[model samples]
Structure formats: structure tokens, C-alpha cells
Target chain A: MIQMNPSMRAAGWLLTFAVVVAGAVPWFLWGSSQLIGGLPLWLWWHIGWMIVATAIFAAFTRHGWDRYLGGIDA
Target chain B: MPNPALLSGGLSTAATSVELLVVVGYLLVALLVGLVAYRLTGTDAEDYYLASRSIGTLVLLFTTFATLLSAFTFFAGPNLAYRQGPEWILVMGTMDGILFAILWYLIGYKQWLIGQQHGYVTLPEMLGDRFGSTRLRGLVAGVSLFWLFPYVMLQQMGAGEALVGLTDGAVPYWGGAALITVFMILYVGLAGMRGVAWTDTIQGLFMLGVIWIAVAWVLSAVGGPAVAAAGLDANNPTFLALGSSFYTPQYIISTAVVIAFGVTMFPQINQRFFVAESAAVLKRSFALWPVLVLLLFVPAFLLGTWAAGLGISVPEGANVLPVLLGEYTPGWFAALVIAGAMAAMMSSSDSMLLSGSSYFTRDLYRPFVEPAVTADREGWLARGGVVAFATGTFLTSLTRPGTLIQVGSTAFGGFAQLTLPVMVALYWPNTTRRGMLAGIGGSQLLYLSHVFVPTVPVDIGGTTISLFARTYGGWDVALAGMALGAALTIGVSWVTTAGVDEAAERFAVGAD
Candidate 1:
């Protein structure tokens, strides 16, 4: 019901996918250092994932989605 | 005579007496603001808890910024940085700021916008609307209470320790503790949200100004942050860097993930989304928060570096800021630094006390017990809740804290675990209430087990991990808990009744 421009929706979903995949990469690939720029690489990885999380969650806020999805009268 | 360290650092009788004045002064100022601000805040429940939704951009911005800058940055950042090295500034603090911006400016700001349109009042209210379940609302409220109490205690301890150091025994632990507690309880109790916001604005400004001065003093004394870091790293390379490449990859990646996503989920922050007058204001507020957060803690890190260079012992951990302030500068300037640290402590304490009260009065009390309760009565309850919660927090702080900062991180991580399912279900109508419960319960179980068990070691494996485990060495507990919770919520939510909040989800998830 919540519609994004094909671009934003696609981008949003893509970012979400990236977050999931990046998070899971640990199951397969591991970094050599606990510190990346002074932190553990996993934490560094989470920082990257957080960006994806925020963007995807924020998509829920875009007004056009509510309107395009027919949730609002307007 | 005081211990050599104390004596060498100018922790004398006269100086200590003056410190007491600053401690008492902070409480007096808070009470004055509470008494004066009460009139402006109105007597209704809305005014008391939500300021009748009239908080301005300037005040709201500062309060929001202030609340997010917890002991993590104010004291922990520099303490850890100094103890470890400058890499944390780049790794931990930078990551923290980045993650914070994503949540506050991105996720949090947008939520504020959406809330304005939907008339969302509380976190559970928002979740309840999305899932259409009274039970979920109650569950989240319960989660908030379980974790919030310990956090409130940590803040009180932070404030109390700073007070103790400043007073140098002229004021007992309880004296400084009682002062801030009474101030927070009275201000939030009497003036409600408006008063808290106003004081937070003042408190925020005071803290920032003080931090800048403190940083300058430290830099002036030690030549600067770069020099300070270089000074320490020259001596101990192992403590400053990842000891081996073994844990490096997993540590950085996991910490970054946890901090970034885990931060915005703090309930105190969730409450802010509902309080915003508009999304635009909230966004602007968040935009400023990153730098503010950076500045607040960077100096502490640099100070830690400076302290280690001087071979200073950061006793009680919470006293890291004051001990540095008192010793690093002249008497007059040290008092100012002391004042600023007080401001930082109070800004956070006041906000949490108010937020905890909101949880009790809004999320827990009014909804489950009496849906028909008047707004005024509900507000009165919140005010009283502030006093009650503050008392509990004070009592908890009396015992010495081993890892004050870690306690905060663990509690915050537990809350972040809830963010996924709760936020997702708002848009994805197919997310079942059962999924929410299952995910949250599973995650919490894992976390509690860690609390009871010892899955990871502290101080040895990772400093950040140590920061979360407190004494138990359970940083892994939180990480595992969050990861499990997120996965289970989605996996479980998908299998159960497709919780499609057709109207809300249609806009949220685009899966309708």
C-alpha cells in the first residue's frame, strides 16, 4: 500500500538487502583485526549496516507512500 | 594528608570546599528553574508529560541532543580512549556519531514526521496502532521499565560521583546525590515536560560550554589531542591497538553494527519522536547532534590519553571527568570545568527521570489499569513516578559500580533489539503480533542467560565489549541477543498471521 517511486522503493529495498547480507557475511568471511580504524571490524560492519537500517526504516516515513498506498483520504 | 595522587592534583581542603559550593549550586539552580518554570508548563496531564506538545525547536533540539550524549561519551569516551588509545576516537566515537546520525537524523527524524501526522503519543501507542494489539503495548512498556531503572541509576551515580569529587568530602555522597535527585524530581514533578526541556536546554548549553573549556584546558596543558595520543602510543603500542589480528575483524564489524542500530532504539529517544512539534525541527536537531556528541566525549578521550601520559588513576570510573577537570587546570578554571560536568550529568539525569516517569504514567499505568483515566490524573502519576523512580535509582547507585559505562551499553543494546520488529511491523502489515512477542522473548532470554552466564571475557578481548559486559564479561550476550531478536522477529512474524495494518502498512512496507 505504501508506494515509493520505483527508484526510492528499489533503493530502499536494496539497502535493506545490503544490511542483511553484510551482517551475515560473518558466517562466511571474517576480518583479521578486531580493530578497524580503532574498533573491531564487526562493529565497523554494524555501523555500515546501521545506515541501511535507518534508510529502510525511514522509507516508512516518506509521505507519498501513505498517499500512494491509499492510506490517506487525499 | 590526602593520597599523593590527590595531593599532587590539588585535591586540598579549601579547593574541595569550593567544589561543594558548585555541587550545591547546581541543585539550587535546578530547583529555582523548576519552581519558576512550573507556571509556564500548565497543569494538565499533556503539559506535564508532553508539554501539551508545545516544545519549541531551540529547546527541543538541545534536550534531544543532551539526552543522547550519555555517560558513554561524556566520561566513558575519554576514559576508554585515554586508557586504550586514539584509535577509539576514529573507530568507536566516529562510528558512534555516524550511527547516531543515521538513527536520529534519518530513522528518528522521519518517525517524528510520521508521528505528527498520525497523532502518535507514546512508543507503545505507536506499536499498538501498527500491530493493533493492546498486549504488545503492555509488553514493550514492561521491557522499558526493566531496563530503564538501571540506566537511571547509572546517571545518578554519574552525577553523584561528580558531586562527590567537586565537594571533596564537604558534601557526602548522599548530599550531592540528594541535591541532584531533589532537583530532577522537583523539576520534572512540578513543571513536567516543559520544565525539563527548558532546564535541559540550559543544562545542555552549560555542559557544552564547560566541555569546550575543559578540552581547551587539557589541550593547553598537554599541548593537544594529537600530541596527547602520540605521547601515550609511544609508550604502549599493545594496549593502544588491537592486540592481535585474531579478533580484529569480528570486533570492529560487530561493534559498529551494534552501536549504529542499537543506539536509536533507546526508549528515552523513542519518546522524543512523539514530542517533536514537527519532523523538520527534529531533523534539524539531529543534524546538530553528531558534532555535539563528538565534542562532548572527544575531550574525555583525550583527557584519558593525557591522564595515562601522566600516570593518573581514573578512580571510581564515573569520576574520570571531574578528576581530570580538577587536576588539569587552575583553581578558577577547574571550578568552571566542574560546573560544566555537572551540567552534562544533570542534563542527562533530568531527561531520563522525566522519560522514566513518562513510561510509568503513560505506557504502564494509564493504559492497562484504566483506559478512561483523565489526562490530569495520568500526568500526576507521571510526576510521582519521577520521584519514585529517582529514589530507586539513587538506592541502586550507592553500591560501587565496576563498569558504569558498560551497564548503559547493555541496557541500550537490549532496547535496540526491539527496533527491528517494531519498526518493521509498522510498514509490513504481514508482521504478526505473535512474531513480535516471539522475537522479543527469544532475544531477551538469550540476553538474560548471558547476564547469568559468562559467554565472553571482558577487558582482554575488547574494550568496547568490556564497556557492555560491566563485570560479567557478557558483551557477546547483548550482541547475540540483538542478532537473534531481529532474525526471529522477522522469521516468526512471517509465519504467523500476516499482520497487515492495511492502512499503515500499505504506506510502511509497500507489501500490501
Candidate 2:
């Protein structure tokens, strides 16, 4: 069962905000490092994350997700 | 202005006019095919949108390959290889091929399975059904709005570029763009996907033949692939490195995403699956598309490599093929190239127009205009959207630089993000609906920010010279968005929603 109760719904905005902050801090620090020199950190981060991302997507698509979303009895 | 003619190794307006006549002749033939295809395509909306799905493996093979090849293979592919060296060719034709192969393996069966169950016509429909969210369908259509404009712009660019080359000064920017826009609008809107697939067969054949002739001529004029390879090796010796090709790793990985993620998920392909009369037709057709892809590229490689061996200067991007055609071949041959190029542009344009309009009409107007709309009205809406979309793209491109690749990459990057959730949702039993929503929402946020911001490329092959990107977060918002969203969708999805709803019956039976 999904754990998202009303409390979790309240937490949604916090997660979204955290996402923005997570991306922004490094970005602000890197501040156009991408423009002048290229965002080495960001690029490497993406490269590393791409692998993770792809694996997650692969798993999500290839493995059955219906059990989680639709529940067992159905 | 009179269409210029080619004189000696260059285009002369008078000679160009002669070539124009040949092009017009080809256009006449295409018009006949379009009109006839329209009549034969039948009255049902499915027939209009997906070619009655009765198309066999042969038609499916040619149609899919032709759709993939587009004007790019004929124009941009050669030129890209010319500038970047053989490395570029291998990266796109081979590397991209590898990505497509992933599609054959991952998403193909799921597509056929879904088509059988739901009579689905597009991605938005499928997503909407799975999620029980017409709002989701609207969301998808909205996302598509961001994605398709750039694609249409690229198709318009191809048309203008081809006309400029074939007509010399006579077919100026506005005129050429207008002509392609009018023709594509007429064919795509009137006949729908039915016209597109049938015409695609012809376009595919014409371009294939032209590439062969052009490559053969160029090779004989120079030597062969070995000689050509040696010449390029001497110039850009590393042109053979799969890793370092001028084409980007982004393209390869992205293509893999496309191959894996998109093979079954694209709206038109979704529609095509339903149109097939039997599941067997789907399997055979799926197997056949790749072979067509392989056959189309051989001559293109030959043309690029041969041109290099002779020390012929390849034009910057699209101009590479035209410049070579004008230089190495004679007048009649030059005219044939014009016709072939038209096929390339038309095939690409028609398909893009259909896909974009489908999103607008089926996904957007229907939901908003009349929530309880019927199938007949949906067809009309699709046609109307086609007119609006075509006119908008034609008009915008006339005012812009008309670079197909730029528009294409932006669209590819944008739409490609959709691949993440859709692909994952298909097979993952544990994936929550919230996860799909999260992945889509999260990725779009990142993708648009990166694309609009246009930060530095994490330059794939070598160091890219990005003025602002040097230290910025190399703006692959699209790529990262897809990745990040994938993670969040999976992670958050599992943690968030309490559990499965009764709505998930279809996905459970034979999800990817």
C-alpha cells in the first residue's frame, strides 16, 4: 500500500521545493560555470544519474509495477 | 526568378529551372498517389488515422523505415557525416540503430499486446486509460504542445532547404516554404495517416534509388569506400571511433532511450498497431522496420565517404548532399536528386503533421470542447488541427533560419522525456500512478528549464565551446529530467500512494 496519507499530501510541496533547492544550490554555485567552462559537476552528475535513472526506468518498465499500484487481489 | 540551372560543377539558375521541371513532374506523380490513396483508405476513422491497420509486414516495413529515415537521412545524414567524418555516420546510422534495436526488444511486444486489448489510437489515450485520468490525457496533450512545435519547424526547414537547393534563386525562402506547406497540409489533412503511409512507400523507394545512384556515381568518380575511408582517415583519423564520432554520446544514449522507451509508446506507432488486423501482422511488421533502416543507410554512407575521398568540400549541414549532387553528377541525374529530396521532405513532414495534429485534436480540443464528443467529430477536429498546425509551422519557419536539426533535437529531447514513465509504467508492477505523474511532472520541469536556458552542453565528443555553459549545469534538462523523474517516480511512487486501485486491470494481464 502507498504510504501517502493526508500528511504525505502535505509533504508533497516540501518535496517539490526540496527538488528545486537540490538543483539550485549547486547550480547557483556553479553559476554559469556551464556557460564559460561547462558544468563539469552537473554533466558528471547527469552521467552518473543517467545510469541510475536508466536502471530505475528499466526496472520500472520491465518489472511488473501493477502489483504495487493495483494491489494483490485484483 | 527563373529556377537557376547547374552549369559545370555549380548550380546555374537556368539549369536549376530545368531541374525544377523534373521536380514538378515528380510532384504530379505524388499528387496522383495521394488522391488515389485517399479514395482507397476507407471511411472509418481508424482507417484514416492508422491505414486500416490491415497493412502487412511489407508495407509496415517500408513505412516504418521511411518514417524513421525522413529527409534527414538523405540531406542531413550525408552532410553531417561529411563535416564530422565517417564517425558521424556510424554514430547515427549504427548507434542510433542500436537504440532502435532496444525498441524491438523492450517495447514492441507491449505495444502489440495493448493494441489488441484496447483498440488504442495514441499514447495519451493509453495513458489516460491506465491512470483513469482524462486530466492525464490533457496533461499529455499539453506536454506534446511543447514537443511538437519544434518537430514541425524542422520538417518545414527541410522543405525550405531542399527547395532552395533545387531551384537555385527562383525558389526563394518564402516561396519554397509555402509550396511544401501547402502540399503537406493537403495530403496529411485530407488523407490523414492513410495518405502518409502510402506516400511513404513511394518516398522511401525514390530516396533509396537516388542515394544509390548518387553514391555509385560519386564512388566511380572517386574510387570506393576504402579509398574514401582512407581520405577521411587522413583528415580526421579518429573519424572511425564509435566513442568520439561527431555525433554525440547524448544522441546514442538518447537514441537508446528512444529505441527502448519510444518503440511502442509514440502516438502514431500506437495507432498503427491497432490498425493491423491481427497480432501476427504486428510481429512481422515490427521485425521488418529495422531491415528497411539498414538498407536505406548504405548508399548514404557511400555518398559521404566517396565525396570525401575526392577531396570534395562538403557543405555545412544540409548543403552537403545538394552541393555534392550538383558537382559530381550531371543535369538529369541532378533532377532525380531533386525528386528524391522531395520524397524525403514530404515523408517527414506528413508524418510529423499527423502526429502533432492528433495530439492537438484528439487530446486537447476534444477534452476541452466537448467532453462527450463522438468519433466523427474527432476526425474533423484532427483535420482542422492539421490546417492550423501546418500553417503555423510554415509561417514561423519563413521568419526563422530554417534549421531542421535544431528544431528536431529540441523536440526529440523534450518528447523523449515522456519515454521514461510510459516505458516504466508498462512493465513495472510496483510502479504507482503517482510515480507516473511525478516522473512526468518532474522531468518536464527540468527539461523546459534546461532547454530554454540553453546552458553548456557536456560536450559529448570533445569540449563544447559554450559561453555561458562553461560553468553552468550543462543544460540537458530534458535528459536529466527524464532520469530524475524516473527515480522520483519509482521512489516516490512506491512510498506515496496507499496501494492499487481497481482501475489497473489492463496493465496487469500482460504488461511489458
Candidate 3:
């Protein structure tokens, strides 16, 4: 029953997908010495998704995700 | 003679005095803030325990963030990075930041709504009222306390190590532990929630500033980030890679899962759910949580990872931060970093102490021992409990059972085992008391067996009762227990149906 704006919901799912794909998989498969910002590529991959996750949450919070979904009575 | 282990290469008497003065000054400021908070808050239990549910966005955000960091992140995190390599950052830094943010939104938003409607302060209080079971409240509190004590001791032990490391054995470990314990008791007992949050905000800023400065200084001093990477690659090529021996796929995933579950179930953190001024405040905090985490963690971990490549010897892993600061930085800078680390410990310590007191006073004492106790009496009892718990942790710190990371992990594992029941109870309407109880109890039994008696075989009538001695590749005992708890809850809830309609109405997930 927890609802968000359709676009926001889609964004949330997209972010989750990104986190799962970028954060979890590459770190295990190709955790090589390829450097990104002085960190391993896989590490940067995870950090990249972390930033994306932050952005998604920021959108959710900003767009009144709970209110959009009718969870906030006020 | 001074202890060789505590002696830093560059520490002088003057540096020691400066470091001590900085640490002491920080503690004094904390006490003053506590006194000021005492004057600001009302004499009632709600005001003292929950800050009257009137916390703004920034204080709530920083308090939660600061409390979450604790001595573990400040001390053990760098040590792990130093010992294991840079992949360790993936375990705690990236994973925890992401996971905890999700949890804060999912759990915290709902809990804040529930508390606002029902006037609840503690998680157990909310759970008990939802289930209409006093025993359930006691059980949750008891479980939390069991895990929380070691965590409290971890902070004290970290403070002790930091002092001893910075002072070069001029201050004994026990002396450091005792000083922190006393200060935490006095401040927490005096200030309540208002004081704790105020101090947390200030301490959080101090920790943030000092870590950024220290990291920049260290990176610049030991050449640029690229140069540091080259040094590490030259000496230990795998340090810059993932799936290294220490960071196998299974190990990294399992550690992340365990830490995530454990961290979300921390009593003090869970209590923060009730103190947010609004749902928006909670949301804003979560929104910024990862950024804050990344800001602090990257530099600290980088410093540690680079230390190994720089050939800076870290004899004791948990002492890495202090030793790095003491030997490499100027006297005042080293002192400032030490004070910041101490701030991290103290900010967390007071919150934990306050939560522990609430658990004891509200959950245990009032229900079982003094059902008719007045609010004024309850406040006094909570303060008294703070003193008692701090003293207990101080005594435990004397043993130096393990490094900050080791002790912290054990506590984290224990708390993680509780997450399943908590989550299910919050969202699932079908979760009966039996199912809930079984979930928590069974998982704990399985977890304890795995951690303490994984291979203990007991023969009764020629039948051995040691079914808990199983191991899985890459799965930490805590994650396994959480999985088992989830299974038990879902399985038991399916066949049975017995919960109050009130519970159903109150806990309808996403049903505002």
C-alpha cells in the first residue's frame, strides 16, 4: 500500500537495480587493478552505485515519496 | 619503564601534554553541554528519554549519523583496512552506507509514525504495546542489553587504546577507560536526550573536520593518492584489487549482510526512530546518510591502506589511527585527531548509555519490580542505571578481551540476529506471538550454537543433540541466523493466526 509517484517508484527500482548490478556483481567478478580515482575499478563501481543510491533517495525524499503514495496524512 | 608497545616514534613530552589537554578539553566541553541540556529539558521521562519528540532535521540527522559511526568505525575500520587491504572499504564503507540508508527509510519512517501516534520511546515499548505482551517487551530489552554491553565496552576499550597510543604509555589503558566511563556516566546522567543530541552534533562536526584534515595531511605527506596507490601496488599488488584472498566474493557479501543487519538493530539507533520531529526529517537524514558516510570513510580507509604501502608499521591494528596521527602529524594536529576520535566514542557512548537506561527503567524495572513507580522516580532510576551500566562496561574494558574490531563484530552479530523478528513484526500482519517468539529465540539459539558451541556434541541416551554444528561457505554466523529467523517466522506464521486486531491496525505497513 505504500505508494510513491510512478516515476519516483520507477527511479527507486532503477537505483536498486543499479546497486545490485554495479555494487554486487563486478566486485566479485572483475575486481582488478583498473584504477578509478585512485581506487580499484570494482571499488569505484560500488561507490558509483552508492552515489546513485543517494540520488534516488534524495529524489524520493524531495518529491514527497511517502506523501505521493498517500502514507503521510499531513 | 614505559611500555614499548605504546611508545610512538615521534611522541615527545610536550606532544603528550598537548594531546592530553585537547582530549581533556573536549571532555569538559561535553560535560558543559550536558549541564546546559539539563537546564533546557523538562523533568519528565518523555522529555529526558525522547527529547519530547521535537528534534529538528539537523540534530536528528547528525545524532543518528554520529551514533552510528561509534568507536568501531573511527578505530576498527582503519585497522581493518590496514591489515586486510583496501577491499575492506567495500565491506564497511560502501555496503554499510547503502544498506543502512535503506533500512533507516524502511524501518525508521514507519517507527516514527507509530511512535508519534502512540507516544512510544523505546522499540521494545512499541513492540510490547503492539503485541499487548509485557513479556515480549522484556524479552526484546533483555536481548538488546545482552548485545549492547560488549558494544559499550568496545567504546571504552577504544578510548583506552587511543589515550595509551597517543600518550606513549604515559597514561595507562585503565586510566583512559576509567576517565571516559566517568565522563560518559556524568554527562548522560545529567543531560538526557537533549544534551546527548547537542553534543552529538558538535562531536560529529569535530570528527568530520579532523578526519578530512588528517587524511589530506597523510596523503600529501606520503605523496599524492596516485603515488600512494603505486607504492601499495609495488609492495602488494592485490591490495588494489577485489576478490583478493581476504575479500573473496562470499566473504565480502557475508560481512556486508551481517554488518547491515547488526547495525540496524542497535538499540540506540532504533530509538532514534522515535525522536525525529517529522517523517520528512527522517527522510532528509537518510537522504544525506550515504554522502556523509562516504565523506568520512573514504579518507580514513585511504589513510590506513596507504599506511601499509608507506611501510608505516602498525603494531596494533586498532591503534592505527592514533599511531598514524601521533608519529606523522604535528603535535597539535595529532592531538586534534585524537580528540576527534574520542568525540566519536563519547557521542556514541552517551546515546548507548541513555538507551540502556531507558531499557532498564522502562522495560525491566517498571514492569517487573516497580509497576507503580512515578515519572520522577523512573527518571532517577534511569540515571542510576546509566551509572551502573557504565561501571559494568568499564570493568569489562579492563580485560582487553579483543581488538575493537573483534569485540564490535561479536556484538554486531548478536544484534543482527534480532533484525528478522523486528522487521516481520513491523510489516507482517500474520506474525503471531508464537511465531515472533520462535523467530527470535530459535535464531538466537542457532546463532549462539554456531558461534560458541558449533561442534559441541552432547550424548543423552546415546543420542547426540548437536544439530547446530553446520558451516556454510562465505556466510557469517549472523547472516545465517537472520536467514534462519526469517524462515522460522514465515513458517510459523503460516500455520498459526493469533494476533490482536489493534496490532493489525497499528502496524499496517505503508497504511497512513
Candidate 4:
């Protein structure tokens, strides 16, 4: 079983928090009506950010799974 | 969000008949799935309630996916996107997608462990046992059922409205709702979690396929993606931009937080925490969750936004999806998509009824009404409860008390009130039973006051203050309730002893 250390846990959570905040609303693209690939830039940002969020979640689950379940052998 | 009234003129008789046939066929498939699941289901509570704890990756993922994306996703999401802007995607897709996945780990993984250890079936059961309070257990169950009632009705209401829109009022609203209600009672009564999960997997896949098809076809009819984007840009530029009147930072965050946390407490969803066959299954499901969410939400919300670009004019209180599809897609194709919408509603409703029955039996009835009930009798009572609860929610749907978003959001807030206390009880060994009750009871009261009571404005000096405002400083009632719940839980526990009990000690031991 892979046990994530405290610092590693903190870093994982902090990185997730950062990604969530960044994707919550595209602050940088706020009020910008520019189009990207026919969709709004902000909408595209969300699409791109969702991909990023999915990657981050996949990584967290891979690395931090034991932190929560803690070697529970189901 | 699609009003039956606007659905009156679009479909021909043949189209209406085809759509009705497709919907009826879908319901039949659901019943058949239930029959198979019933045959496979064991006589014990564990098998009926949690599928014998043997569900694998695909079924678990899709069941959770289908259960969460209900009529709200099918109707309200698009309606909001069409009316407001694409920012609705931020709430449903981006923020909620990520937040709920994280919560699925933080809350669900822990619950999975405890449930495995204790043979727990419901959230309240776990919490009540951990705190050694029957009253607290009942309170949590009561809160969950209370909120679940509205959400279940929301699905029925969506069904009625969607059907009325598809058949152009050939199916009356009551008839549409009755169709789903009767079918749900039959299937959910016949098959428990196993049936619901299997059917949910089908429904989830069907919904995903139908939405993507609808989007692809509509984009083609409306001159493709670039044309649709240009049309939206020319017609409703505000939709393309951020900082609209409705999609404020506060609004987005608060809505996302409420839904993400509140979903964890939903009787239907909470019960799912215990259904995974293995830790690896749970891990895979949560990891894939965000991707699945985006796959559906983007198309659903984007379709609504594109309707604005295509110059689709929707009346107030009506959904844009059916209108958009009716305009751009073939009759058979439109009918097929409406069937997909029905699939979404049924998937959600069946799961809700199944889990609500478990909560009623395991958490409420078994403990409070029948202490020595046999396992077989308990299963029968749960099935009966499914019928009664579905019938009750169906009748409530006939009254049409609120819009999909209105009732759904309120229920989300109500469930959000339970999150903090449950978290504390799960992780904190010093959490007292009294504190649990106070936290849940008080926070619920606070949240309900905001939901039920009309706001009153009072003049204080020169500034006006609105009492019971739903949102304060951008944070909504759900967040407010959670803060108070957490505060009271921690504060009350600090001053009170946990007593000499094994409940708290059980969780304090190192995880296996």
C-alpha cells in the first residue's frame, strides 16, 4: 500500500485547491468576449480547465488514494 | 424548465406518437431491467440495498453519474445557460465537477471504510451509531428524506414537462408524471439497488449518447459550430462574456459549494458510497467522475447557449432544448432525444426512491417503529416504502410547487446543512451526541427559515437590512448553514464530554 506523507498530502490538496479556484471562473478572461475556435474564450477556458481538473483528479486518486482509505483492503 | 404551455404547436401527430412510443419503450426496458435485477437480488438487506456490495467499475460509475445528472441536468442546466450565459457551465461542469470528485474521496472513501467495518447502509445509521443517539439518527434521516422529497418531485415535474413538450400536450402534465411515477414504483419495488444501478448504467449511457447526437445534429442544422458561435456572438454577446448580472463570483462559488457538499448527503448518493465492490473501484469511479460530468454538462449547457445564437425565442419558464431540437432536428431524432431526457429523469427518480426507502426502513422505521423486525420483513417494508414515497412525490409533482431549479436548489441547501456535522462526527472522536443533534437541528432550522420565509427589509439608520436573506455577502444560505453547523458542533463538543462510549473510539483507531 502506498501511504502519502503529510507534506505530500498537503501539497496534493493545495494543488487541487489551486486548480479548482483557477477553473471556478476564468478571472483572466472575465468580460472578454473574444472567440476561440468559434466559442467564447471564457467558455474555451472552462473546456480546457475541465481537462486539467480531470488530470489533477486522476493524479490525486493515484497518489493519495491511501491517505483517505488508509490500507483498507477491500 | 421547459414549460408544457410552449410545447403545444411544434410536433405533428406522427411525431408525437413516435415520441410517446419511444418513451414507453424506454420505460418498458427499465421494468425489464428491474425484473432481471429482482431475480438476481438476494433475500437479505445487503444484497437488495447495496447490490451485495459487488458492483464493478462501469456500473458504479454510471449509476453515480446517472443518479446525479437528473432532470436538473437535462432541463434546468440548459434553461439557465440559454437565459443567463455559458457561465452556468462553471457552476455545473467546472467547479461542481471537480469539487464533487474531491468530496467523493474525502467523504465517500471514509464512509466506505466505516460502512465496510460496521455493515452500515445509510449515512444517518453510521452517524447515529457513531454518536450513540437514536434521536440524532432520526433527525439526520428526517432531514435527508425531507430534502429528498422535493428533489424526487423535481424529477417527476421535469418528466411531465418534458413529455408535454415532446408530445405537444398530447400527454397532459399529469399523465406524463403519472407514467413515470407508476413505472418507478413498479421497478424500484421489484428491484432494489441492483436494478436501479443496472438501469442507471443504461440510462446514463443513453443520455450521454442522445445529448451528443442532439448537439452534433443541431450544430449541423444551424450552420455548424463556427456559425452557431458567430450567431451567438452577434445576437447575445453577453453570453460569451463573464460578469453578467447573474453569474457573479459569489453566486458561482456559493452555488458550486452548496451542490458539491449537499450531494454527498443526498440519501441516494450517500448510499452509493457503500455500493462499490472495492477500493480500486471507488478510486476509478471518482477519478473518472469529472470527465463524465464535463462530457454531459458541456453539451447540455452549450446546446442551450447555442439556442440563443440560433435565434430561438423561448418563453419565460420554458426550456430551450426541446424548442431547439424541434426546430433543427428530425421528428424521430427529436423524439429519441426526449426519450433520453426521460431516461435521465427515471434514472434519478428510481435511485432516489430506492435509497429513500432504505433510509425510511433502516434509519427511521427499523429503529423507531420496529426494533425486532426480521430481515425479510424489513425488505418488504422497504419496497412498500418505495411505493408510498414515489406516490407521495408524484402527487406533490401534480401541485407543481416550484420550478426545477427552485426546488432543486432548496433541497441542495437543506442537505448541505448536514455535511459539516457528518464530517466532524466521522473524523473527530470527541464529537458528542448532543452536539450532533444541536448542530444538525439548528443549522437545518436556520437554512429552512431562509428558504421558507419571505425576506423582510428593515431600516437601520439610513441603511436597509434584509432579514433572512438567502445570500449574505455573496455566500448563500447553504454556506451560512454549514458555518453555523460546524461552529456549533465544534463549540458544543468542546464543552461537553464524549462520555465512556465505544462509538467514538471505533473511528479513532487507525484505518485498516
lDDT of 1 at B352: 71
User: Who wins the TM-score comparison?
Assistant: 4
Which runs in model 4 stand beyond 4 Å of their true positions? A1-5, A72-74, B1-12, B315-317, B509-512
Candidate 2, residues B1-512, lDDT tens digits: the string is 22234311244555666776677667657766888888887877667777756776656656666676655556666665665544343334333343453454345556556766777667787777777677778887788766666666666676667666655545665666676778777778666666777777777777777778787787677566556656655675544433343345454444434333433444554455456565455445533433444456656754664466457764333356666777778876876876667665766677776876777777777777787887778777777777887788777887765355545556666767787787777777566767777888888777676656755545656866553231223234455666887787788767976244415556654322
By DockQ, rank the candidates, best first: 4, 3, 1, 2
The number of the candidate with the highest lDDT is: 4
User: Per-residue lDDT tens digits of candidate 3, residues B1-512?
Assistant: 33323433344576676677777777888788889989999988789878999899899988988897777888788888877887777777545677777777667787887787778889888888877778878988998998899999999998888888887777888888887898888888889889999988888887888888888888778777888888888877778877667677777777777778788778888898889887778878887877787777878887788877777776552378888877678877887887777876887999998998899989989998999999878878888888888999899889988888779988888898888888888878778777777888898887877767647667879876654553355457678789889988878878888755337666754534
Worst 10 residues of 2 chain B by lDDT: B1-10
Candidate 1's chain A scores what TM-score? 0.44
What are the per-model DockQ values? 0.09, 0.02, 0.40, 0.50
Which regions of candidate 2 fall more than 4 Å away from where they truly are?
A1-74, B1-14, B94-96, B230-266, B314-318, B374-377, B454-477, B498-502, B510-512
TM-score of chain A for candidate 2?
0.38
lDDT of each: 0.61, 0.60, 0.79, 0.83
For B106-157, candidate 4 gives per-residue lDDT tens digits of 7888888888878888888888788777888899988899999999999888
Best of the two (1, 2) by DockQ: 1
The residue-level lDDT of candidate 1 at A59 comes to 49
| CAPRI accuracy category, model 3 | acceptable
